[model samples]
Target: MDKLLKILSENSAYTTAQLALMLNEPEDYIKAQIKEYEDSGVIRGYQAMVNWDSVPDAGVMAIIELKVTPQKEKGFDEIAEKVMMFDEVSSVYLMAGGYDLALVVKGDTIQDVSAFVAKKLSALEGIVSTATHFMLKRYKEGSVALVDVEEPTDGREMIV
Candidate 1:
């Protein structure tokens, strides 16, 4: 991986000047490289790792493991593309374990996610089976910690 990309992945909020300073390159060069990466599709959109648990109206998230029959010529690519087209799907990854694909889906409620699996995902062709696991809490996402800080409390008791 390129050094610029690595830095950006860790913190995309860095200015071109900051990135250039870190990489020991000129700001213009850094800007050009970033532009080239974006134009060539090397750099996708930037995102923040949000701690949704703190939000009151946060939607439910689930990890759906899928077992699918690979197509004759297209293999998993065709099915994966079709699955990615769904609006509720945040991510879809091809796995090498018991399941063929893993999907990260989000909905307003557990029932909403259930309906998506039963109606949309299962109804698709070549889909053999699925196992959905709801995310109860997130301790870490990417390089960020979602856990709340706790004040230190001494275990000693004071005697009068």
Candidate 2:
């Protein structure tokens, strides 16, 4: 009913009253719409994007490449499930080409990640090979976070 999504995307902490006032809509309407969006899985709730750069342990990050055979009966889901349960594994992706999976793992030291792979991951069965590429810097990440842009030429519109 209002620009609720736009408002929420920019500032997730905005209260229903604040959003309603900004969008010039009633709070009840905003609430109902948000509820519907949530139910439909359109709005997957709010989150605070942590500035990992400021974190004390931010320097520690690794990209672990994995080769896993898709199980006969269970398939990628089964293997992916085990990979995700590890505390060090931050992100997991079912990949194409040479590697079957790509894992973004983080820990205080390389040994932490290695132990996870050697003890936890490799031991899990179906895992073929693994190669780790630690990340030094992240140029961009996650949906290209919509910060203030002076030139709004609709890049999405133009590119597509």
Q: What is the lDDT of residue 103 in candidate 2?
A: 94
| Regions of candidate 2 where Cα sits further than 4 Å from its true position | 1-10, 21-25, 39-45, 143-160
Q: Best-fitting candidate, measured by TM-score?
A: 1
Total clashes, candidate 2? 0
What TM-score would candidate 1 get against the native? 0.91
* Residue range 1-160, candidate 2, lDDT tens digits: 3467776776788889988898788999989989998999989877777657556765478888898889988889899998899888888998888888899998887787777778888888888989989777654455543333465676665554
Model 2 worst lDDT run, 10 consecutive residues: 140-149
TM-score of 2: 0.73
The 10-residue segment of model 1 with minimum total lDDT is 147-156
Among these predictions, the greatest lDDT belongs to: 1
Clashes of each: 0, 0
Name the lDDT of candidate 2: 0.80
Residue 110's lDDT within candidate 1 is: 98
Candidate lDDT values, in order: 0.94, 0.80
